[model samples]
Target chain A: MDMRVRLTLAYDGTGYNGWQIQKDGLTIQGELEKALSRICSASIRVHGSGRTDAGVHALGQVAHFDPPPKFLNVPWNRALNAVLPPGIRVLDFARTDRKFHARFSARAKQYSYTLWTQGAFFYPQRRNFVWNTGPLDLEAMQEATTCLTGSHDFNCFMNKGTEITDTIRTVRNILLAPGFTPQETVVWIQADGFLKQMARNIVSALVQVGRKKLSQAELKSIIQGRDRALAPATAPARGLCLEHVTY
Target chain B: MDMRVRLTLAYDGTGYNGWQIQKDGLTIQGELEKALSRICSASIRVHGSGRTDAGVHALGQVAHFDPPPKFLNVPWNRALNAVLPPGIRVLDFARTDRKFHARFSARAKQYSYTLWTQGAFFYPQRRNFVWNTGPLDLEAMQEATTCLTGSHDFNCFMNKGTEITDTIRTVRNILLAPGFTPQETVVWIQADGFLKQMARNIVSALVQVGRKKLSQAELKSIIQGRDRALAPATAPARGLCLEHVTY
Candidate 1:
């Protein structure tokens, strides 16, 4: 009998096209499948919990796969890493029940966005990991998050091209706190599910509030209006990371 | 009258060849000179405090150049960043007297090396910034540093190809401490002058001591041996960073 195995993946998405297997480009899934197949000596498929856009990193993205029974007892953590590239790794692996699906069994996901809010030029070591935004009004950004928390019809935050009609998502909170440096701020958002570009779009609105270009009251009205046209542009992809996914 | 201008640089050396200008490679100095020459409408020469090997990063590497009188008032902090690639950044700048040389007038320098000493894989985001060594004896590594502190004849620690006969220099200390994660250790080494691959050579020996292959007393013997062949191989350059330079 074969058992389902789950793997927690961490990757610097800057080098890949995205998380999905695409015909024309390199991706996190494609790399995983290639490495796994080589180790198993057979065809292998990988199912990620979800897709991350290009340049979006992941600290703990989950995936599940059914491996050949002969390979079940392999020391996966070290075995996978030995064959994988430097930009990707298997952080942890464990046996799971057949009912456990990488996507449908997920309960919530959390993402963190980094903003270098102090100066025109931040440290070069973190250039790929942050959005440089000079200086921002921290208080206004915090106030904007309060309104975005909890369950809401976030149609306004979804990308205009996305076809999802039911756009409600239960955003637990948007925690804004200082990062490694005082001038840097990391915004963490936890939600049951995110619509296409929903988290980035929400962050765009909060940054607008921080800039004083949009008021907190205006943000509330935009959600009630449910018009994507009224929302600000989607934030850049490099600043975002899939921090964790809870089942 | 033309005055000397000092510039503090920060760069992710993963992309550039090194700190010096070379005819065959894309180097950090070559890029800086190109950008400055374009801005000044004349060829500009930059003098770094020292050269860093390929793949070594810098948080506060210092450099100096004499600017034309007409361009003296240029807001160099923002101007340099506007033209340089994302990998290189000018953190600070100021006008200085000709007596303050970026190379000759330096007092001391600090470098840091990161090691992920827990598992086969570390966070992919930090893959380029750390040396992944599966579990090391922390106490042994700390003990080895005791014999290496202060001014001494470090001929054994210098690289073989280096021709410097006077190898005596004051090594302030090498501090090994816990990093962001419990399993990660960061080593900070401060010195008045670093010989070619001296910092890396010291770390290689320390790591060997941590593994129990080289005891603390054996390290002392190696120093006494004063033979470059007796020293361990130099550590990888990616894990090293020129943290600071004080004048």
Candidate 2:
């Protein structure tokens, strides 16, 4: 008998190419499948809640897979963790109904972007995890985020190469809050779904506003324009993290 | 004219061999010297407060050097940080009198060791900076520390191969405290100076007491014995950090 297992995972994305399987580079999915296949002595595939780009970390990413009955006796969470590298961890595991699908059953997601506004230097430990942008006008950035909240056609905020027909996304909230230090700022966004590069693109536009390069009214016009060329470049992948996926 | 300068630095030890220059691989000293040489347009050498072993990090490791007077016009903290790799940073810099020496003038030093008691998994971000020891008896470890504090000959804890004639050192305090997370514990030790591997070796013995392999009485006996064979093995270098140096 085959049983469905749901796994909640966390990872530092410094070493992996991305969440998807790629022929030329290492990926989170590829390493996971390899470990599962070795444990069960059969080919295994895992479906992730969504794909995260290279260098994008995750605090709570959901995935699911079917395992043979023979492997059911093993403590999967511990066994899988023992085999996985230190950069990735299986935070929790449980048996689930066959109807559960990681990608299809997800209803919403939350992402957070960290910006280090400290001038000159950054802590060595966090150099790879946060965007070091010297300094920013937080008040201007916060005001600009208000223009991005609620339902809108996010075509201008997505990667132009994506072939998806639907560009509409419902942004539940956009929050800009102070982090642990005076120079640190965290931007958290919750949404029903995100198109390719949507979150990063939005962050880029807000950063422009913080730098006083674009006004809040111009931000609204950029969204209304519905043109990807009108928006600023996407923010670096290191600052963005998939914080949670709601089922 | 040569003017002595003091530098307060921080670095993640994941990439370098250690604080000292090494023939086989990259070291923190080598990188810092290279950057200084480039800025001064001449060969440069730096004297650190002490040499940390391989894979040991630093939060406020101090150093000093005299640069050519012409080079003093450049902003060192900003100039060196711009040229150095992301893993190392010059946190502070200032011109000091000729009598100021990073090593000889230091009055005390503080070292911290982090142990993660979380079962089954380690956070990816801290995987290299902490010891994932699962669980430890805090009370036993605290009791064991009392025996190791105060002025004493730490021959049993120092690395056996070192040729330093005097093993006498004064330990001002040893603190066992909770870390940021419930499952994490931190051990902070302050002393006039440390012998090679002394901090790690003491931590190893305390861990042995936490596991009930040694009693507080035996730990005291180990110090009295003044024999390296009487102590437990040294802890891994990853968990140790040179936190600060006072001058």
**Highest TM-score, which number?**
1
Candidate 2 — which pairs collide?
none
| Each prediction's DockQ against the real complex | 0.66, 0.55
lDDT of 1 by residue, A1-247 (tens): 6588899999999878989999888899999999889899888888988889989999899998888889868888788889999899898999987899999899999999988898545788888888887788989999789899999999998876566689888999799987755668999999999998888898889888989999989999999999989999999988899989999
lDDT of 2 at A106: 94
Poorest stretch of ten by lDDT in candidate 2 chain B: B177-186
- Predicted complex 2: DockQ: 0.55
Please write out the lDDT profile of model 2 over residues A1-247, one tens digit for every residue: 5589999888898878989999878899998998898888899889999999999998788999999877776777888988988788998898887899999999999998989988765777677678888788889998888899999999999896668989999999999987534567889999999999899999889889988999999999999999999999999999888989999
TM-score of 2: 0.90
